[model samples]
Target chain A: MKRVVILDPLWPLEESADVIATLDVTLDKAAEAVGDDVVAVLAAPEQRVPADLLDRAPNVRLVGTCSTGYDNLPVPELQAQGVTCIHVAGYCDDEVAEHTITLASALLRGVHQLDRFTREGGWWPFPREPRRIRGSRLGIVGFGRIGRLVAAQGNVLGMDVVAYDEYVDEATMRDLGVEKVDIDTLFETSDVVTLHAPLLPETRNLVNARRLAQMRDDAYLVNCARGPLVDHAALGDALIHGAIAGAAIDVYPVEPPPADEPAFGWPNLMVQPHSAWYSPAASLAPYTRQIDDLARFLRGETPVGVIPGGS
Target chain B: MRVICTDDTWPIDRAQATLDRVGATVEFAYEVPAGEDIVGLLTYPGCAIDASILERVPNLKVVATCSGGIDHLDVAGLAERGVACCNIRNFCDQEVADHTMALIYACLRGVVMLDGLVRSGSWWPYPQPPRVVRGARLGVVGFGAIGHLLVQNALGAGMEVLVVSQHAGADEIAAAGATKATLDEALSTSDVVSLITSVTDATRGMISTRELALMRSDAYLVNTARAALIDHEALGQALEAGEIAGCALDALPIEPAPPEEPARAWTNTILQPHAAFYSEASEARSFDNPAEDVARALAGEQPLGLLQPVS
Candidate 1:
């Protein structure tokens, strides 16, 4: 039997047994793959699959990561050797959009800060008075799949939804009930601005001091995308100086931010531990989708999750 | 003619703009002084109006309250004295609906709990795993204007909605894209349940020990309505025993919650300072509508917001 190694210890391999029952593959959990018998290796977002994996398991023809972001996977080298590189995508589109809306709602309604305030023996003239969600302007920073979903959800809630994306045209956004605006207009006028852009060299630190300064003092920010999308120091300073009202972030500049995280001290800020893409239904979807794609690839079928085999 | 405004926070300028048409002037006062010149009395939720107030303002033609609820007004007794008892309605329906939905999203997504978890320097093993919002069940406990708006919001978000209302028929609920359910069914089946009902003899203490026991262990309860709708002691027990996962309360038995409030120490609860029905627009409407109704009564036209019109 061919071997399939899983790099995540808690991957629950047994749950995917039915999906791979037809293939003569034995699943094993390990830090790394080895031996000529190994045909495939899978990993979670946190577990890195090194580029030299082909050196140990030369016959390994497939590699997959159970997440949308393949940052931890060394894609270029593995693809050079003709390995099928795959990562789950669109698996949690609804989840991330929902979580983004939740964060935006929390920031607008002052859910987090007020909870702490009430606990610490304070009351109204609520240090941060809750605002109306309906009619409040919602500025979406990226108008991709997830951004469109957020715009739809925000529209249903009666929020005035607008978006900014250089790649997407105004008519497309307007068709989705979203107004197209420039990045400066988004930051300056929105009651809450959310980011849904992919991380790249040009997109990194997209929300720097300049963008933060352009935002209205009563406005809020929400980021569930990559951590580096916003300058972490600028976010903390915005909250510290009351330049903006509040923010809710699910992803951090560092995964599981180190102890003594400066974010803990930022007033009027809500921190989440990179869990925006999670839900009971979504937790197993990425893995199962990846495993099914691997099974498909082994059977000479074009798999859905294959990342293009080039840099 | 003079309109006496007893609430210090009332926007007299806006009210004067309305009272202008009826040739009535508005004045602020700590109490309604015994004066025949007082043709209208504008009060807020905090100020109670009984027949005894008639002895102070003998010429009062209308007693108007800047709130939807008329619990503080002796409507019948005041109407017997040829005084119209007017209270604003439908002024903050959108605000309440938006706030309730925000709390619902906050509860299901576990943003507040996760924020606390990250701040405590703990990551990964989420204290409570965030759940998916789309396809998650939402139980709405009332079917008034606010409740209807809330169902629209939830249904728009792709949530399966189960509405419990004594007055709404299944056809009506289904017409609104929701299924009708009994209170017990809603409590047991919903992932997040919101209470938006008024307090009445039949509804008071409606969610007590027996009702709390029927809730799912993972369900979240949201109360943006009157605190009397729930039994505080039973709710505290349900949360501590983990019978119910958590609750988000925007109202409490006491306003300006004292330091000893028990809900403060309850597990996985979010508290707000009874701030659900507020927004710059909604606030303006609440005050302006009541002031306009008072002006209407003084002008010999029928007042729009009268709980009991003078015979």
Candidate 2:
């Protein structure tokens, strides 16, 4: 029997007929379960696998990560150690897309503020400033699966969607009926801009001061991608100086950004604690897919979405 | 002159008493009073008041409305025949603003869809998805009174707010503690962009396909402004292509949807019967001045809610 070690902390698993979990895995509960015959290691993209973690689990033959982005994995080392690697991609695309819409709509409609005002005992009665969304342009910064999904949803709501991706050609955009504008035009014309590109060497800080400066005065920025795509300090300055209108950030430079941090002081910024990825329904997708993939892999059947490279 | 008040309709009786206190004979109408000269029209939408009925009043000098919108009236032709027109535009600001928020929330939260799903026995196990509103960016396309109210409401919800109004100034927005962006900026970055501005030549079809392409694909749009502000076909294409997440429309380029229109079949979009500003409180406010304005104008006083000459 294969002994598998699970590392992601957010989900709870019931002891199943075939698989047993490494129970109570935490920093304080460390070193309690160095099983002698570990065959598989389960983890998430954000987590750092224990050092000597591979060697510590002597019988471990594979590492299965819960994310497509495998930046944390030392691929060459794992391959040299004779370990197979697995990654799950496109699992929570719709879920994250829906969440993106929810946040975006809430931002536009002033749902939080209105609900808060209503809950605060009529401190602010009377809608003081109402705006309309009709006749507005919507720009998307990336055109990946999730980005495309978001655009599709926006289209359903009667918005014009323009998209830009360095790698995607105009023909592809034309097929999608998307305007293939450069980054500067996108920044200048869009009333709402959302980030969806992956964090890569070429894509980091894509929304820098210069790009931010190109956006219209009343524009808003939303970041659900990695935080490195935006310079937080520059964003704060932009909001403070009224360079752009306001911003809603679901990802951050640092997770659980310090509670006492002064960066929270920017009046025109909205920050969610880096949690745009998981909704209850979406959380189940990858888990179920993982279980099914595991079952298929163990049965010597080809599993869907198995990353091609070994280790 | 004897004025008739319908059952439970506008407190025309109270208005009548006010009129009679100042010396005018008023009668309650279970039906349109026989042989009565009903000069001013105070009818609701979908009510029957044909042009032939107007010919009954030989001494009719003015037509007044007990509503903000005057779609029920033939204003142009009536004015051509020299009938002075009046309506009620104030007093419903808060109620209309509240209605706008309600539509916005309903669209963003998928309230209607989730409710239907749960009631139809497909509960999906989880209660409808939980969406976060805090720390999102809001773009208000029009900075009129209602738009400004929404901005304040968005702020109270902990959302970053921006205003896109050609009429407004940076100092005015800054004083309101909001960032002022141009319409272009507001469209691109707003997670949601709502319309609350009056429709004018400069504003008609403002959100063209070119502009819509500027918005982020994940964004949602809410429009409580005039329908002509957006290009509906462009919106339909955008929605079909997923250029935007979803939309909630309070106005249609064509009212009553003509039964054979494509808009009637759209499921993801939310379409109100264009009664967003017709709440109970709004109705009362609508009744206050217009009814009196017509009565006063009949008695030769200044009309309330009167429009200035269309310069």
Candidate 3:
């Protein structure tokens, strides 16, 4: 009999117990499971599975991460150990895309500022004039599933959508009703620029000082994918110097960014605590799907979400 | 012809230049003051053009408002004085619709609350559960240009839209991919109810205690149109009793809502100053439209947006 150890309680253990029962496997918490009998370990994306921890379960054959982003997983080390790694992707695509639009809409319409103003007993007709999303340009970086959805939402709002992505072909871009443009053109032409690229070595600090300088003076920037994609210091400086109008950042390089982060005090910037991919539905779906994938793996059938070059 | 602009801060340079080209003199003032025989009164939506104000401008042959709503202008009074009243129609439909959707997204997803929580250092997981907007029901009241645009955007976001409007026929609503429902039905079934109706005797105080009671306790109400459409006192009480989940308001019965307003103390309520129709692009149209209307009035031609007085 195969034993499954869940390193982290991704979802309520009781709710997931029914699904795990189908595989005819006994579920045990990480603390109780020991030795070579444990063939699979389920962990959240935030959980760090160091080699020292893996050494305890030498016979473990599968590691399932309940998240789309695998930055937390050390892929090479796991593959070298002859372990199959799986991650649930595309589960929160709609949630993140909707969040991207939410951030963009809030910034464009001045929801945060106006809400505060009214609460503070300020009068109508804000001191600053807000820009409209309709008939404006929305520039999307990394035209993946979330990026494409954001573009579609922008189109429905009557915005002219443009995008910069190396992988998406021109025909696909046209089919999605997004105009393909170079990075610089996107920054310069867009009324709002949103980042959705995966975190990669080549893409780190993609929105640096030079790129921020290229954006329109009244334009807004939204970052929901990852924090390193934007140079936080440069973005702060750009916002302070009025280089750009405002920014809405959902992900930071560091979770729960330091208290003294400069962007925190800036009136024009809205900082969210990397909760863009979280909703009641989104939080549960990834876990449920991962559990099903784990069940399939245990049944000696090919699982659907296996990461490439992982096994 | 001489034109008196009621708003001193209005960017009338373009309009002034246009008037200059048309051989008309223009004067800007914060108020009309008594005994000013202005040939044309150029005003905005918030300015009160009551009978007394018109009496002050005895020679006011034409009253042109730089907004779509003519509720502030005494159309009957203007007509009684043989003065033609003109307003810009559908100028900021896209702007208001965009703002309405922004508020809807903010309330439904709890973006503002999450932002507050994250800013307060509660980072890893959001304390409040966010509602997914996709597959949700959105009830829109008054399917005019702004309402129709909002419906289109909401549908594009994969939401089921229900519309309630006296003027919109069943066929028109169906054609827009929305179901036509009575006000009571829309209130009870929708996850988010948005008010986009113009303020009139028939529509004023439309969403009062009875209508609010029909809404689900977890639903939200978003109002970007006139504030008089809702009974704020009832809304405050309902929010206190947890009758509705929340509200996002762009306008209030009183501009610069008094400090003692009960709704201000409700944490679940989001209050924005009457700024839904404000944008640099929209502002430009507000000024340009009145300028053109004044020019046309001076030339003895019917203005584009002439409003017929209600009998």
> Which of the numbered candidates is closest to the native, going by highest lDDT?
1
Winner on TM-score (1 vs 3) = 3
lDDT of 1 by residue, A1-311 (tens): 88989888888767778877877788888888999999999998877788899999999988998998787788888988988889999989998998899999888888888898999998766788788888899999889889999999999988999999999998999899999998888999999999999777789999999999999999999999988899999999999999999898888877879887898898888999888888888888988888889889888997899888554
Better of 1 and 3 by lDDT: 1
**DockQ of candidate 3?**
0.71
User: By DockQ thresholds, what CAPRI class is model 2?
Assistant: incorrect
User: Cα deviation in Å at residue A11, candidate 2?
Assistant: 3.2
Error of 1 at B6 (Å): 4.2
All candidates in order of DockQ, best leading = 1, 3, 2
Docking class of 1: medium
lDDT tens digits by residue: candidate 2, B6-98 = 434567666765566436555555445445455555554334333454566544456566655555556665665656767777666654565
Quickly count the clashes in candidate 3.
Answer: 0
Q: B247 in model 2: Cα distance from truth in Å?
A: 18
How do the predictions measure up, each by TM-score?
0.91, 0.52, 0.92
lDDT of 3: 0.84
Relative to the true structure, candidate 3 reaches a TM of 0.92
Q: Report the C-alpha lDDT of model 1 over B46-73, residue by residue, as the tens digit.
A: 6778888878788888989988866667
Once fitted onto the true fold, the runs of candidate 3 whose alpha carbons sit more than 4 angstroms away are A1-3, A23-25, A31-34, A123-128, A258-262, B1-3, B12-31, B52-55, B258-262
> Which candidate achieves the best DockQ against the true structure?
1
